[model samples]
Target: MTAPSPTPSIDTLERRFSDFATLGEALDFAATGKRGLNFHDMRGNLARSYPFSEMRSDALEMAYRLIAHGIQPTDRIALVAETGPDFAALFFGCIYAGAWPVPLPLPTSFGGKESYIDQLKVQLQSSDPKILFFPEELSEMAGEAAAQCSVEGIGWTSFADRIALKCELPVQHTDATCYLQYSSGSTRFPHGVAVTHKALLNNLSAHAHGMQLEATDRCVSWLPWYHDMGLVGCFLSVVANQVSTDYMKTEDFARRPLAWLDMISRADGSVISYSPTFGYDICARRISSQTHVSERFQLGHWRLAGNGADMIRPDVMQGFVDAFGEAGFNARAFLPSYGLAEATLAVSIMPPGEGIRVELVEESELTGMPGAPDRPKRYRAIVNCGKAVKDMTIEVRDENGAILPDRAIGKVWCTGPSLMEGYFRDPEATAACMKDGWLDTGDMGYLSDGYIYVVGRAKDMIIINGKNHWPQDIEWAVEQLPGFKSGDIAAFAITNGGEETPAVLVQCRTSDEDERTKLREQIRDKVRSVTGMNCVVELVPPRTLPRTSSGKLSRTKARNLYLSGEIQPYAVAA
Candidate 1:
């Protein structure tokens, strides 16, 4: 057995000089190398490892089996994205079989069975997969969800056994449809973003160039395979560049995040890994709780400590650096980036070695609100997300569709080869985001000397710890209460102690103090049931929430009023 080493002795593979036109070519090139994927358990012990050569061989064989089972080229094959060798082989197998693979999320941190089932059904309906493959452990849930969408569902073991090997693998073109990436926030509703082979390869190439990846570079990731950052940035990018990677499931990392650092410390090569701001916060908090945090981890070789996926918190980044700085961790290793699933992965990445840069601008300037200069001024620290990746162009446009000048925040627009083709079978949704060739990212940000600084989201989406939670979804869950009405609840994000968390303000009618407290607890439980978030539930007087001119509940206005202290809660304890 080959012992696990960060920089194991193996034949060096030649790097691809030219960019691959498709993932197939990329994987074929990677198979020439000795580097591949290494899976690990929560304890940081190696579970299994597969070199690129073995991965490609197994994938090709599985592709033949899938083809023999009448899975036509470009057919939809949905897989429950579990972090294991099965998912690894099946993902590549779909690529080899010329089938468009749709990676669905496993159980999330918050949502329970019903919420997960609802999410699965929505994605299944949107993707319209011909078959859904899941591990045996999740067979009942996956099969039930697949049945709801009228699709065939098979467990991994049965799926492999049932496949025949009488037919040949289908040829995949460079420009063919590669996979469908559904946005994380689309669980309440699903719109499958269609990414082509050319688009994926373009993004992968941009990642390789942006990161300045080298042969000796290794990766450690605990991000879910369903997430774009995990699938493309961590998994596929390494494959394209022939870099070894250590994998821990997202749940595993959630339970024991220090394992990620442990793996990094053991690896005898340069390390590259990325996470959202919350991930850094979680790790820092976990370490703080320990009585005697060891100094065994060596992060001196950690080259790219990336922060992205949601809003980047400078304070959180500082906390992480402070906690690990003594253990050979460098503050300059943090690489703040900005991107979305619609763009395939990265639009902008902080230049290597530049580290985190913050601009402390007046709050009035960012919000376009007039304020007395003589008054105690409030400032917001916006972290620079760096310049656009190779070949990607970014523009900030105002509400009227006119492009804004630099440093003026507006809707972030991007146009690049990595942009998605469109939403699968949903031209209306596609038309809403795509105009001409540019994609409206639905994110608000600004640019200064080519460096991008994201301020907030254009939509009423509350992102807590990198996980997306739609305000409407939270409100709907609360509305299920006996006394609550549809428009009586509002959910939004609030910054507390340098961390962004969800806060729901409810318009209550009753004045009974005990009754109201019970109601507040009920709302919290309901929201938690749906979103898996423990939000600050505040009961406000009726009509406290602002409404748009059309009489619709304006969550933005409500949030603004709450932050400005204009909307006071009644009979509520903070």
Candidate 2:
């Protein structure tokens, strides 16, 4: 947090590489003599390999067909599909045509068709895309929604159809919009994040160089394609690096976590990957199953296991290491990295060989109470998110923008070439976030000895009786209690009118009267012991906690559900 030395000017870097004009050109150069993509559909036992030549050809053909279908250079197209060859074709197709491709989540409502239609209406109103592309299975429903919304120029097409289209012409582009990534739509309305060819290529160059990815590295992931980490981490990074990758559907992985490990082990994947907390808990749960032990899968070959997309949990990491250490997995291979869509994927990666490091501070000091001074406590485990990537700078700053010294908790702000140009079509929001080239990430954390430690989101910080508390800190405390699964707790602040109180919600393993009572007491006592704040605890069934597509808990959604009465509160013990 000390006033960081001045970051090198972007202008200086621009001058250094003035030769390359656009992303397509850079990609064309990078792809030379490199294999592009290897698609593995584990569910269907299908594998398809695309060399760079074929990929470029496919991209160009899709671009020609899109233009023939009346898509203009600046027109917007919305894509609703999972991670697969189709998604890649549509994304690169948009780039080729100089149109913007907006990736949307698969409709998540249990209300069936009507719910999907309503959600589509919201997105259509915000995006106003000229055309919509979806899976053939979803065409009828999407077409009906389009008609219902009175969206013009609607066409039903399959992924195969798009790929089959001939490459009759080539459309040249010097400057054009490539893709549009929508915000998570968690807090407020979602805005599109516009990424250009040049920006994307520059960011990819930085990422490939930072991660030290090689052409022979193979990637296997179950992250959703709609999210930035999924799209960029697994798909784009592999393609940009010209490596082979296998993708498993996220739901499929959730239903059978062991399959993820089986695939990685079978493939002998060099670059096995996932967000931090996901790999840890998934392995911890799966390895304990008798079925998982029968078919032994050695993870010794797995390198560059990444943990990102949410707050990296220390216990989760330790759980993974303890569970898999006997199976030949190295703790040092777990790379706790950081990035956002605005940064075009990865901003910084922890040094490759040094896994994760955790710090323990006196709980009272964190809550702003006058107690024992901070002491270095030995943690059986640590969760270090690594350091900032080369050429990027990170700072912890107070609310007023003044940088704080190391070990002082504050907002995490970053400045780098990979930062987004700005929020698409939202100048005011853009201006608020991007000041003097520094992106206010809204994440809370501190730096200690050149390592980054994320606490929680600034907006998610709970203030009760004049003490600051990170929801993660409380959640961590509750998770350690008996009968609580790791990562099963979510803490958020609930406010009505001008009064605010901290509420703790946990997913319980059992609904038995005695079990429920014990859980409630355990959660309350644990939180109070850690933060000195009395909390109201609610218990729900396992998997009832709200989660984003990528499996990270959504505090915002959980709070909304509580406020709307959709989530019922548990009875407090008298």
Q: How much does each candidate deviate from the true structure in C-alpha RMSD?
A: 2.2, 12.1
> Model 2: per-residue lDDT, tens digit, 272-341?
5765475468668666645344347678877878888766666677778787777678898888887778
Model 1: weakest 10-residue lDDT segment is: 4-13
lDDT per model vs. reference: 0.85, 0.67
**CA deviation > 4 Å runs, candidate 1:** 1-11, 163-166, 288-294, 372-375
Q: For every model shown, what is its TM-score relative to the native structure?
A: 0.95, 0.73
Q: Residue 218 error for model 1, in Å?
A: 0.8
Candidate 1, residue 76: the lDDT equals: 95
